[model samples]
Target: MKPTLKPLAEQVIVITGASSGIGLATACAAAEAGARVLLIAREDKDLRPIVAEIVASGGTADAFAADVGDAARLRAAAAHAVQRFGRIDTWINGAGVAIYAALRETPAEEHEQLFRTNYFGTVHGCLAAIPHLERGGALITIGSIAGDMPSPLMGAYAASKHAIKAYVEALRMELGEAGLPISVTLVKPSGIDTPIAQHAANHEPGEAQIPPPVYDPKLVAQAILHCATHVKREITVGGAGRAQALFAAHFPALFEVLAPKAAASFIDPARPQPRPDNLFASVRTGRIRSGEHHARRTSFYTTAAEYPGTTAVIGVGLAAGLGALIASRHRTRH
Candidate 1:
């Protein structure tokens, strides 16, 4: 049986990594929509003010402090959510960390920690949320375009996302075969303007910056909320990301040849030196968007992907327009 997910106002959501970035953006948006939100993160200090702000705005929100890397602590947070809010209708595994360094340069311990938080954290969340969601609900995990297309410098981070994509897909199949009422979705976003770059453990000579054509964190939040109500298998937020994935898949040799040229853009020596990173632990939190670059406010491809019939019509229109332009040019030349 397919799961009948509840509307935003009727649902209770637990968001890990809710202190910053996509997670924080989602939490705030969910609360604004009248969902009971449980904000989980390593820092209770950062969460407290955000929760208070949400409460002050007439939203139901509570803060839970825990590292998603710790299964015991994560499970405890899940229990607390159940205790605070009768039931969980949606559980978003958004907790993740990044390392801006080559695999060779990164220490063995850093790579392990990245996997523990990014990959295993999702595993723990899925296990912990399944029991509560048996009635019917959504399990959404934040993945990345890097999951589909491996990146340099951030190889470890990309690998973790790739693992997450695989794990989430497998879990979905297992649950579907068992006929459970659960909606499992993987949200793979492109370069989102979040604090991740700032928080990354940078080993390069300069500070880290998300590559250009960054989308606002709200775009990811929008996608997450949409998946909460609608049953979707996967959603990639940016068109540029989807395009790159396609290019990499279709022409791997060429992609490999050209991809390295963009690696230098990932670092910026002009930015302030020695920025604080959160590879080992949480540094600071509470902000959503990184103001480093101008972010695109909307994604046409993402919106079109959500509505297939519309995309089809748009595709046909583009084809007809191209045909007309070509014919007109040919006639003029003749």
Candidate 2:
């Protein structure tokens, strides 16, 4: 039988990369929804303020600093959350890193680091959280559209996401074969307005920006919160992302021609080259939002992803209405 997930109010949610971006957004949303939140990140200084803010706002939250890339440390964080809250209802593996440069320019060690954090980190989180999760618990990982489609500058990050997608699929199948009552959801967001670009290690000239049609991080947060209680196989966040995935699925050759054009425009040629990077170490303090470069508007992709039946119904209704109008016009002409 399928698992029946508990609502956020009754959940004890442990989130990695909770100090910033989508992870931070989800942490706050879960806390606001009455979940006991355990926020983990590499820096305590970053996690402390966010936790304090949530608690000050009458939410239950605590910070545990750890690098998700470190298996033992991440496992310890999971154990601490279980110890503090009794049990963990959901584990969100949201920690990841990105690199913006040509594949040739990127060093072997940087690629290794990307996989270490993005892939191995997720593996660790899953292993640590599984034993403590009762029936109906969830494991949500934040993947990227890059996992589905190729892009130019973020080759390593994309590769890591692809690995994550495969790993999650395998884990999901294993859990089902074992008849364990748990849900695994992979959330693939398009370009999201997060501080990730600021934190990424860049080899390119100008700053690295998320590809166009960026969706708000809150949209991603909403999806994460939904998956905490509901079972969704996977959901892509932005319209552009969904479009690329579909296009790539049906027309790979055409996408290959178009994708690089899209990628090339991501960086401004006029922008100063040789900018600062954050790959080897933490250069900036963690924050909830990034710069104002990304779009402030939400995407219809969120609605379509979260509520497919409703979207289909709406599509059908519009088609019927258009058909009726055409019929009326024909009658008038007659």
Candidate 3:
């Protein structure tokens, strides 16, 4: 039998990387929805303020400081959550790091670090949370459009995301074959107004800037909350992100031609280069949303992603209409 997920209010949601970015946003949203939230990250200082803010807002929240890359530490964190909340209903693996540098310029250690935190951290979280997630639990991980379409300067980061995509799919199939009551979801977001650019290990000549058409991090948080209550295979955050992924999948040669130009356009020549690298350590003190790159506040793709069935139906209808138009045009020409 298939799984039926619990509502957000009744859930004990665990969010990794909850100190900032998408994870922090997700923690606040889950807490607001009345779920008991557990925030895990490497920095204890960072988690404390966020938890205090959540509690002050009349939300139930706790903090666990641990390196997501460490399997033992994640297992301990999971145990702590179960002890505190009674059970785990949803586990979100949102802990990850990015580096802005060409593959050749990137150090071997940097590539290893990215994979350890981004890919292996997710792997550890899943392994630790799976046994404890009593029936009807959800596993959600944050991936990137870069996974589908490799970014020029973010080769290592993209490769880690690609690895995440592979394993998440494999894990989904395994769960189905076993007939478990669990929902697995992967969220691929394009550029967001996250401090990732400022935090990333920049080996490039200039400072890093988020790719064009950035959306608010709350959009991503909304998507994550949706997955907690709904069953979905995957959801891309923005329309631009979805389009880039489709283009990468269907038109590889064309993507190769345009991807570099897109990357070049993303770089701001005015900003000074070589900022402090957060590759191995945390740089920011405590912040939720990174207002680094100002862009649109809403994303149509994010709103649509919550309703997959409606999106599919609309896609099919549009395709059919186009086909009818082509047929009529050919008939008229003949």
Candidate 4:
């Protein structure tokens, strides 16, 4: 079921990777909902406009420059939020990188980079905010559907998500027992039609291959706000994302059958290095497109991100599973 817009007069939220895509869209939505928004990205290069946009819309927002992978930076951002907003009621980490490589061929550096951005980045946000995070606040992580099932070429990204799931689940359990309002949430988006695919890292020369999926980014963004309004413990956003998550849980045989085809779409060529382009990158989508039934966020216990096989994730998720269709940095005529 779809959820109606809720008021956010007294809420404050900090979102990482707010310069573009899901992070950017979500920041806009949060501000419109009446919350005081804190935006953080790896650089100030793209933040000024975002900050100005929010402020111009009769909402409150501020941008801070910081890399999600940097613990020190996140700490400072978190500290800044408290001092500026008086308190932080919500935290969302949307910064991520999709690297192409096989389990054996995947380099230690790439693995570390993916983990830093996808996994530990979330961790840093949580850790930095925990002390001042407030008992009644919420912690939200933007995870992929790949976390549950094994994707062929995108192993590291999936692995990082698995790690995130493990951490958030445990955090939820602990917080529940502690009777704290500090609820933990994981948002698993399907093929968000976002520019994440465009920005994804390719193999050096020839690495591996995979298939692509599709979904809407704004839908994912709306679903996120859905969670924030109600603050559900965990939510899988959108239709395809939910299906992929279900595949990991209820139907392994089907997952195995479909996994390789999706993987081969991106990484099976076994090239000496990675391919720079995302074969499944969709046609440019810009301007306001209206559609019925804006996707809803539910308290549904959807599946966790889990693509163990390296190849499966690359194709099915990186290529096939698209979530948001918006790209702040795209060259499309707006």
Candidate 5:
């Protein structure tokens, strides 16, 4: 069994992108763990319910509507967190957008849009909240396994997450060097049991061929709440997640050899971009509708009991991994 993550009494957590998925789960988990939560996401309608849920359940929560990538809004959010609660104990950067297309095939604006949200969002969040960080405060951001290993169909999205990993690692070092009271931890999770990929944006509307590897968002959220209480170098969710992270870190050749298969099993090329009916440029919700993906009953790769999810595919990854090893040896000899 994984080590149990403990309670955080009276501390405050500010989670960006709290309206759905992991952010939403984290907010609930943190509040359940006895911490005050300030939820930030683009939509107030979505953010409000969670706050209301917490408040209704006798947990303290406040919802703030903002684009985490916006400097002014993030700065304001930091202040709001401080005002709402005495100190900023944990700040989570969770709101992200995925723009997955072949490099040359992707539009410039689309490319910029990813970086603006995934990378800049975290930067803005950190910038705003760091000033008010307490002695044991934590700065957490979600990075993908795609960020660590090269993902073909997800180049743009992966690059943005890759940049996030770089940013947090460097920030950790710099803060440690300066002896700041703040502690920063990065989370690299695999495919989650959420609507993230389903809601992924693409050039057209349809399913695309993807890769095999996957991990659950609920599991990642569980791991995230764990990190908030216990600051460590990194906490990767799921079993294959840690292995993949290891492959990317120590064996580039192994990771390279595995990339195509990885993409095939994991990347859903058939998944279409958010060509929404509205003009507001909202992110696609894919299979999971916004305000509809409830986390109370969510779990990794599958819901608590609805249907078998990603875990059902574990055997496939093992087979692919073995195949990748054989392919690697053959290439080395050639």
Candidate 6:
């Protein structure tokens, strides 16, 4: 059985890690589109203001404070969303943390905590959302390009994302075999211009920075919202990220030769001191975009991927036109 999702205006959406970054962006966008949104994060103090702002803008929204790592807390959050909004049409698992260090350099406790939030958090979100969405709905989890490619300094973080990808894929298969009406999607984004780097635990020489070719967080939010209504199996937000993954997959030796230098570039030597991070706890900032890096607003590759049929027709037309132009030039030369 395939899930039939409702339009954004008529749906109730629950977003974990909603206090900031991609989660906050998605919640605000959903509410603006008229979905009843329940925002979940670890800090009520951080969530309340965003809720108030959304409410002031005449969007239906509420705040729920809970750690995604805690299963009971996630269950409670799900119950609260149902109690407040009646039914959940979509659930987005976007809560995650990062660590910037070699795997050997990272503490065992930190590695465990990172997995608890990044991996188990998605698990908890899926378990909590399935009951509400069995009738029909979307289950979206925010993954990263690192989930597919190797990340050097962020080994633990990459490992967590890889685990998430595996788990989400297995869960999708199990749910499909069970004949449940649910659309499960994993959204893999490249280095997005969010506060993730600022919130990441840094064990390196300087502050952690999202590698180059950073994309806007709003693009990720747009993808998430689109999946709320569309039944996409997986969506990679940035084309460059997709290309990197493909290159790594096809040319493992070359990628391995260049990966360490590429990874070391993530550390900014200009910033000698490490910044405050949210590895163990929540940072109280609600700003969406990280102002440190300039992010591209549009991604033609993403647009083409999202609407492949249209792009395919356009590509054919362009190819034919170019061929005619080249033939004309050859005739003139002759």
Predicted structure with the largest TM-score when compared to the true one: 6
Give me the runs in candidate 5 sitting further than 4 Å from their true place.
1-7, 208-213, 248-258, 266-334
Candidate 4 residue runs with Cα over 4 Å from true position: 1-7, 204-213, 266-334
* Candidate 2 Cα errors over 4 Å, as ranges: 272-276, 294-296, 321-334
TM-score each candidate: 0.94, 0.93, 0.91, 0.75, 0.77, 0.96
- Per-residue lDDT tens digits for candidate 3, residues 232-301, read 8999898987888888889999999988888885566777654566778776846556666676678867
Q: What is the number of backbone collisions in each predicted candidate, taken in the order shown?
A: 0, 1, 1, 57, 24, 0
> Taking the tens digit of each residue's C-alpha lDDT, what string does model 1 give over 80-102?
99999998999999999999888
Q: Rank the candidates by TM-score, best first.
A: 6, 1, 2, 3, 5, 4
For residue 257, give model 1's deviation from the true position in Å: 1.3
lDDT scores in order: 0.93, 0.86, 0.87, 0.69, 0.70, 0.93
- Candidate 1 vs 6: which has more TM-score: 6
lDDT of 5 by residue, 66-92 (tens): 887689999888888888787788889
TM-score, cand. 4 vs. native: 0.75
lDDT of 2 at 185: 94
User: Clashes in candidate 1: how many?
Assistant: 0
Better of 2 and 4 by lDDT: 2
* Model 2 agreement with the true structure over 12-46: per-residue lDDT tens digits: 99999887889999999999999999999888887
